[model samples]
Target: MAEPITLTAPNNTSYSQPTGLFINNEFVAAKSGETIETVNPFDESLIAKVAAAGSEDVDVAVAAARAAFKNPAWRGLSAADRGALLYKLSELCERDKHILATIDAWDNGKPYQVALDEDLAETAAVFKYYGGWADKIYGQIIETSDAKLAYTRHEPIAEQTPLSVLYLGTLIKEAGFPPGVVNIINGYGRTAGAALAEHLGVDKIAFTGSTTTGKAIMRAASVNLKNITLETGGKSPLIVFDDADLDQAVKWSYVGIMGGMGQVCTSTSRIYVQDTIYDKFLDRFKEYTVENTTSGSQFDEKTTHGPQISKTQQEKILGYVESAKSEGGRLLLGGKPGAEKGYFVEPTIFADTKNHMKAVREEIFGPFVVIQSFSSDEDAIEKANDTEYGLGAAVFSRDIVRAHKAAAAIEAGMVWVNSSQDSHFGIPFGGYKQSGIGRELGQYALSAYTQVKAVHAATCSGAHASPYRSGIISRNSSLDRGSILQAGDHVSPSKRPGAKA
Candidate 1:
């Protein structure tokens, strides 16, 4: 049996005061003075009350952001200077990593060490990477005919564009955009989220969360045609080939699915194994889970998996397990929530799962896995790409050529070879199909946040009329040099050096 982890509100801690909405670098109360109580998902204990930003508070935040964007101090700063601020923020986050990690553990219900090490570290890296690119946003110059010059100017789209809502606040601290150039208002999606997305002033909206909500944001932004980027839900697949390193594949699967309580959007929820090694792989995978993972609190280093974000989530995962069994999916291991005070579920695995079952189709968003066997490579690709989501997928194989081929055929924005759940800062992360629009991360991320304009200069000394009595003739004649450059020295036969009349 796993033990319950408990947390109580500390009177002496800095967080004793309720955390309020962060707007314009200041925390303030909502207009209605409404608030929501954050409960520890583990013990259902009162953690802290967060201000629920109503329409009025959202208005204030947007207005403040607008002011900052227009202000000379922020708008006039060079991109290099802006990036430096992000670098500073990253340093500050590293200094207080321990404290922030604790907050995430207590509020988000993930392990303390992971929150500190992986989440916080990655958050800092994200900021640093973007910061480095701040000054590097560039455009291209194109050559034209007749001394004409043209170039494209890459510039910030507008003031206070809400590119995304970093629900994971740690990512926000890591994004390092200039204060006014990138504003984040912390509030529920129904209120603040909706306002930011639909606000006429906002140029674009980028969101990462459940698909159900992604549609809502799209609908709201549609009214204004506000540019949108969504990194939505995913039912990612992991294909284990017959020639794979079985031990590593099984171990990596365990880490990917069970590490974050299976809360990650790209977590490998669906595992497809070649028939030759199906039973063997299952044996090792189940053994690893039983020996390693345990349902428990977020603070314990001994526990590999913790409670879901809340009780509702716990019920949802349990429901899927039942649905899977009812639909003829064989439950290989755990299928029930642990008998404990917290919202914890066992590290469950199901075998012989059908393609159409809810567990296999929907994003379970909990610690659960469904397994099915594939007889051929084509079948494995078919099974993996069956989901509507094309967010991410993984393949394990010893042959490099086979791995690359499988990775290419997998219908996902990103694919992993012989590994799972590893993400880097410069690599772009987003999905194709229903996974969402626009990439986030690296220079691609910055591209989604900006727009482009072309600048052209036409130098001409007028007053000399065209000999053909047409000004457009000069435009065509001037193109000869450009055409020569573009198409090589292929002059007309009449103008050839030796054959010319």
Candidate 2:
């Protein structure tokens, strides 16, 4: 059995991080005595064993969240007040940015500096942006006849919502959803994840991870007829047109392929080059890959790429490289596992790949990119949207009209022009089709996290009477269905308390 691992700061660093589960407003141990070990991909060694929550812990977390929601302190509070709290949390996150970034680096094998600057900054921005939208929510009313007034009330659905806070502080306080409206319990997608999804109290579940895990989450969420928003795996496409800047395209494309060690959900794993610039793009891409292939520990200042999150992930990436070769995708550079004693797969680039190959279809969530050729705009769009997943896509072209046309044709939620992965906190981010449902980030994120309720104070006159007041039905009467609004349908006063007739 794995034991809880305690983390101590090196030298005089005062970073006493929380190792146990964070439930409700406090961190506590699991009700069940299970634990999960955090493996260091740098050395393929066990780093720490954290308290693992099972079904019992899930029940406790859900109950606490339920209590918080029902109480006047949380859910009953005004939207402005909730927004204030979220803003405060964002401020706190920003204050302790270094600590959280270090935690993310240790937990998820990304470079420490990148995690500190980019990941943590974006996480804080997401919360702060939604915090501003908390009080700005509103509803609408439709115009009706003089005798009738019809309005719609958008209301928040009250039910248990379990979320996975993957890779330590990556999504902590990042979600812009309503407070107490959605509950998040952090654990791996097996026991804690499965239990939360299958919990009868939960109404919706949102996940961001591998496709295999997404299928599991969907299956579990199905048990209770719960809605799901899954941001699963992606082998996103990056199209480089003949008119694109070769130097810029090659650099940015490689960044997308290996940024965060290429662990991003919408990482550009597939590259499509126009036949005119196909050879040029390949030459520059291969040159950059060869010149910039350096790997060590994530904390190393000189290291450009880091190891996979675990030994299993490393093995899976290596297996794909072998599979790609067998499936007829020619390896241009770095196709084998690294020699370092860690979960390191070399920054791989495969050329001569076809859209039909497994490398093109599957998401190799590592430092891997597959390049293929396209002859026309229609064919490029067809190949781009051919995957089962459509999270994010990018097209590199100087022609604005052609870029926009291609952007509209690609079936992904987010599309980039002349860039690969340029995400902003103010923009809505999520996938179309099987990639995910709804959107996250910006003011739009508040919509997914909340609902609207409308209140009207109209005069208590007979203005809301039946639409058809005439007793006789004319030749061209629109109110042919007289049974819907009869003048004296209520037989007695007791039967119809608010009847006008």
Candidate 3:
């Protein structure tokens, strides 16, 4: 058993924090005695020492998961029972929301309220939504010869990874999943994460992190031909048309780039305003941003914004601010450190930026955004699609037709009209281009965990010329269903359908 460390937040919230590598439904120490220091990003204080898993620990964890995959207790479980386990896990998460939120605020430098009210809530909803889909996963019938019955069967691909550190394991432990059904480990992405990606025992990998790391995992998984679903980097765009409700657009634009200190992967840091309203929109946007943003300790209720995840992140963001300045991007709002001690950064906006500049093209994961003006819809679409990333985008306009047109034209997996970053657990979430691979949430996420196999069996009375009709000259169906007459002279297929154009 792992020891629990007691912690007290600035707000007087006390909780027992777990710091272990969870495997086979139990918490254990790293084989190398390695530990990663969990730091409180709010004030650079040490939170606790969490066990650091390496290649050896990952190998052990994967072995356990592989064993569980073959275990009758798990493999023989009914689909509804699997879903029930997920539902119970979701409830466990909701029950411990405060503890989880406090951990997030302390470790991730996010506002406690946002972590508690939004992030934790959304996570619970996600598990519940997927739980509802456990029994609904099905494959369709394929058209083949009348002599053989053919269909597809889906099976669990591999291990169930932890959503994040600490609290998730507690929930899994409390949820009563069979031993080895889930595993959690804590270590640097370069070590433990790389091992999981490259481990031959792992059949599927679902990762969400930096684009560089995602690419590295892609390369690693190629060795085993594992199924990989990555939700990676984004320098997404949000366009504000001339006829849009300026106040609404300004509000959403602020939320798009400035929310979460712009650490979100889908943060719309690139804003293109129609030239007819560009100046006015900028004016209103600045006022709204300044009025709304207040960077301070994550535990402070009055603080609408929190610090970056670390001092390194803070310096990286500040460096980007300087790069924007050097590139001649107009600094429209706050551009300095947010607090004296904490890793806080004031929300900054740069106007008059060009598309070709690094300040405009790169994914600067910070509370900094750049603005540009476009003369027409064609110009807006062109500028928005300029980035190599295409995760998320949004369009704002009063004209419904124009809004939808721009939304469709923007090359992103998820596009919103007259809104920004609104996500639903029941809707698919992922990206296109270099942004990522497959979708994560909704029914589509099942594809990540399940593998399909086509099963065919012969039902013919006796041996025929061939099991498949290779002699058929026609590329279309040999005969139409519900009709006595054959559709084509090529009958070697014998009622079998052909490939469609």
lDDT for each of the candidates?
0.76, 0.72, 0.85
Instruction: Give the per-residue lDDT digits (tens) of candidate 3, residues 204-239.
Output: 988988899899999999989999999998999999
Candidate 1 differs from the real structure by a C-alpha RMSD in angstroms, to one decimal, of 8.6
lDDT of 1 at 468: 34
Clashes of each: 2, 1, 0
TM-score of each: 0.86, 0.85, 0.91
Predicted structure with the largest lDDT when compared to the true one: 3
Ranking by lDDT: 3, 1, 2
Per-model RMSD to reference: 8.6, 6.0, 6.5
Candidate 3, TM-score vs. the true structure? Answer: 0.91
Q: lDDT tens digits, residues 1-501, model 2? A: 222234642212245444456555445667766656676667766656556778888888777667666777666778798788678768877887776776666666677788888988987787788788778776776554443455656555400111113223223434333333443444666678888889987766767777788778888888887767777778789998888888889988988888877878889999999998888888889999878767877777777788887777788888889888998988888876776597788888888898888878888788888899999988889889899999999999889899999999899999988888898989888887777777777766656655555443343564454334422245355444233446866546443434456
What is the TM-score (0 to 1) of candidate 2?
0.85
Of candidate 3, the 10-residue stretch with the lowest lDDT total is 158-167
Model 2 — which ten-residue stretch has the worst lDDT?
Answer: 158-167
